[model samples]
Target chain A: MSEAGEFDFIAQHLAPLSQGYEGAFGLTDDAAILADVPGLVITTDTMIQGVHFRKLEPWDLVARKALRVNLSDLAAMGADPHAVLLSITWPQAVRPAQMQRFVDGLKTDLEAFGIPLIGGDTTRGGELLVVTVTALGQCEHPLLRSGGEAGQDLYVSGTIGDAVLGLEVDTLAGLTGVHKAIVEDRHLLPTPRLKLGRELCGLASAALDVSDGLVADAGHLARASGVKAGIELDSIPLSSAAETWVRIQRDPIATLVKLITSGDDYELLFSAGPEKREEILAAAKRAGTHIARIGSLIEGKGVEVRTTSGELVRIDQAGFTHF
Target chain B: MSEAGEFDFIAQHLAPLSQGYEGAFGLTDDAAILADVPGLVITTDTMIQGVHFRKLEPWDLVARKALRVNLSDLAAMGADPHAVLLSITWPQAVRPAQMQRFVDGLKTDLEAFGIPLIGGDTTRGGELLVVTVTALGQCEHPLLRSGGEAGQDLYVSGTIGDAVLGLEVDTLAGLTGVHKAIVEDRHLLPTPRLKLGRELCGLASAALDVSDGLVADAGHLARASGVKAGIELDSIPLSSAAETWVRIQRDPIATLVKLITSGDDYELLFSAGPEKREEILAAAKRAGTHIARIGSLIEGKGVEVRTTSGELVRIDQAGFTHF
Candidate 1:
């Protein structure tokens, strides 16, 4: 109804982003106080409006997506979220309604994950909105992409490439009923797999979150771990919508490979010991998250996809390069 | 020379900036490993090109300026430098030469203060160039702005308003010789009184850095501490350059008032026990710093300046407001 003052804006909109996480003091004070934890893991990710997201997307979703992407980074390291600093590039011509709704979405995600927004900078900038979120996490020993051993089983949480399928279906005409709803939901609200990642802290040998297509991100893991990760082409966990959509158009294998390299899945790609496979499966079930046995880490570099006939297929590149 | 690879860019440019700091692991790893110390103080500030600095400014000066501003915050809280995270929004058109110079400048400041550039994010954005730095420090107990008590002495380290005057001269460009040099230096490099702030940790009742000119920032200290500060206008220290410049211009009081409200004076503004003034002054001298007693904390609601004629002048608003 009216313009909020600077202090009130911070108290209402920004502070709630870091509301309920353990060790994070309430944000009412000038600074957010955090308790000293054992193993602190900190990571920063910046999202630019046109570069990271289309302006056409709802402002509320933009706020959630910004927080989700940073959370995904913490999830990749198997770290528990403690607090985050949100540096926002406030765009000109942003209405009070938009600001309120945007902050509301930010609060929703923060309260859901129990992380508080600690400290941040606000500045006037161009039409392009920039949200830089630095997330602080704690772990006994962080799960790194460099720790994957040869012969370890590679598992991916939830389904892959649903966001891709959702994008395609949302653009095409005459897509109706449950298909439309599912596709839109997948695109708008990405699940960051925080619970699954926390469970995999000790269990996962090496891990990374799928941001840039499965194939590309998996390739990063393989390269970093100094091991080859071989995946069965048919074992990729594709959505029912993706299966139907691909059947109507191109060959499923080609489509699957393309999807793997497409990015924005936000699922966890992790390596665990072959001996621990049964334990991992049981844990995945208990977490209410899927774990698809996609591949196995082998002694070598480079990622190789195998045909059902055991034929090796080479991919040109693993993931998207920002440059 | 050929263009620098991403890894090389990090190793060459960033590694040197992290020198002389206590880091568990530096820029070599995917994530920085920071050892946690209890009572650690953290603060973040973001500066954008065009918003905070001009591109015409030397890369080294920009680097120095950015680090100084963030360091000012830590100094205000009476914290010692430990480590820093530098997030840069790089322009796509920037060549390696430009980046190299920028890195060189950043490295100078990092080395000077013994505050390492531990971790950061670099991303592409629009016309605006953003630099968000999070500086972390350790303190036994931080001197908060809300700690000042009635009957305490309010003091400011070094001189104030020179940086503001420097900004004015840089834009107008009608002055020359020492007049121009002092103003430019003030604008380009405003030192944070780190030693004084840390020394006053236990002795000082409350403290803060004066970025947003003296009168205004003192207002912040007063409001936070729940005590009103009374200032003698004659007690406000004016740089020789500021005084000479004022003599060349119109009414000295008006000019002084204008400079007092112009932001970007990175000096320490703090309150201490009246009895501890001598010890505070001696500690400042040992730290190779200077401080001037400007006012006293009194039982009231707001701040007022007493003139030479014993007239108390009420000044409500102080410094600059970005919004």
Candidate 2:
């Protein structure tokens, strides 16, 4: 079939995603008009193929990951997505079929996240897809990385590095059965912890999503909050299958250490007061999620990783640096 | 020398752009926290090298035009720019020297326009630079293309087709004169009609910026407003040099027709009633700009060109359509 026309395709798929968005204008004008709501939290993230993701991945997974990553940033700030602007760049050319499938996959994710792709730009460029999604959200006193107190407890939502482990599994040979598929799926589609983020907004002292590995992102949170963080290595949550997979790979401790340092976890790392700890844990359990009391804020700088042997491991490079 | 570091580069160049902007959460946080303000307007536009501009163009010119295009859209709604988010896809891997120059140019325009670069995403991709700018503005009642009424006088701000002629002269040889540099500058650095836009916001019934040529964009205004538009060729404010150049090369009338359909003339094409014509003229004078009565909206849908001899010439295509 001929490629879906831009206007028609947008009208059919994009309109539904924006339905019920309280705005004088949503998407049907020269520009999308949003009512000036209080506390507008806006964030933008761009992912380029080969740099952020490999083209070897499926189209659906790519679309899902791109949106999820941006959503993850909003979640870190405890914001609900209001609208999104998608600036899409296709390699000099894309097959009409491929483009259609890509747009369809994107449409599905936008609908799922309740964010309308309101406005953006499209252009031809070199090989690789570059998609920059700018999200407009609303929050009352957005959770900032700088809000953590020195004595506050640090907690993380969900397992730490299953996605990284999954990536390794996909590349290595001799891995078989359900474990491999599960690992690959984890690497492909990471669920942004939106519910826990919303619940922790008022309760948590400070927060940020783990994107550039646990160690690196932890440092970021600490630096932003101007407080050092101490994490007990044992407190880093690992999936049962992931743990077994790491153990089978050789030195389990080393493997786990490497995994924790690998980026793309998309989990929320937050701080909470001693009084709010029980309430936070209860909320996580009710939501069918796990909270790991990984660390606590300290009156210093950087991260201190305490090992099982009670020795602190100092990691200088915390996460991925794009530049 | 090592390339300029990302953080320091942003701090030095982009920090000043946010000076007078309201609620601009600098580059430190996860997102920009915009304070709740009524009557906010948003618009986005993207410029790609080889598609929107040539790589050989000066960095300052590219930065200025990239910003001007988006500003033109906001101006169409009679809004003043508050903040801008730039999503940049570098064709080659980013180098610090080139990046500094690019950012410096962007900073200059942002400061001149009183809009700050609040946030952006940078990614590596393709062989062409893609800069997508999303401008946020605020106005009481945004002027939309759908607000025109039948029998409204269709007018344009400043001159039309100067940029198109400039582009032609800059690319093709044999057109040697002061016109070459002046036209090239016009094509490179367009002054978006921000003042007229603000003044016309409440007065003009319908408005849109002329990006994709006058005829095509005027047609868009007509279609959006559900009215027919008729343009008088003689009334189009083509510069004397442009008229002379066209008269020597081809039929000036046909050239003018093509100019009306050529893209990249960042003028404002708006429709207002005769009652507001005097007020619009006065506003243009106050802004030290010219207003041209190019067309009129009627009770039909299609656009027609009125020749100097009174014969009507219908164009097959209105503007360039990039899919």
Best by TM-score: 2
TM-score of each: 0.91, 0.92
Error of 2 at A305 (Å): 2.1
lDDT per residue for candidate 2 within A196-220, as digits (tens), equals 7878878888888887788877887
Misplaced by over 4 Å in model 2 are A1-5, A12-16, A20-28, A90-92, A122-128, A166-169, A251-254, A314-316, B1-4, B20-23, B90-92, B123-128
Off by over 4 Å in 1: A1-4, A12-32, A164-170, A173-184, A251-254, A310-314, B1-8, B15-31, B171-174, B312-317
iRMSD per model?
Answer: 3.7, 3.4
lDDT (10s digit) by residue, model 2, range B1-323? 11125455556666666674444555666677775778777777667677678767766678788899888888888887778887776655656667667877887887787777777666555456767787788888888888888888999887777788777774545466877777777888888888988888778999988876788777778877889988898898876666666777656667777778887778888989988878989888877778899879999986888977999876666764444
lDDT of each: 0.74, 0.76
Among the numbered candidates, top DockQ falls to 2
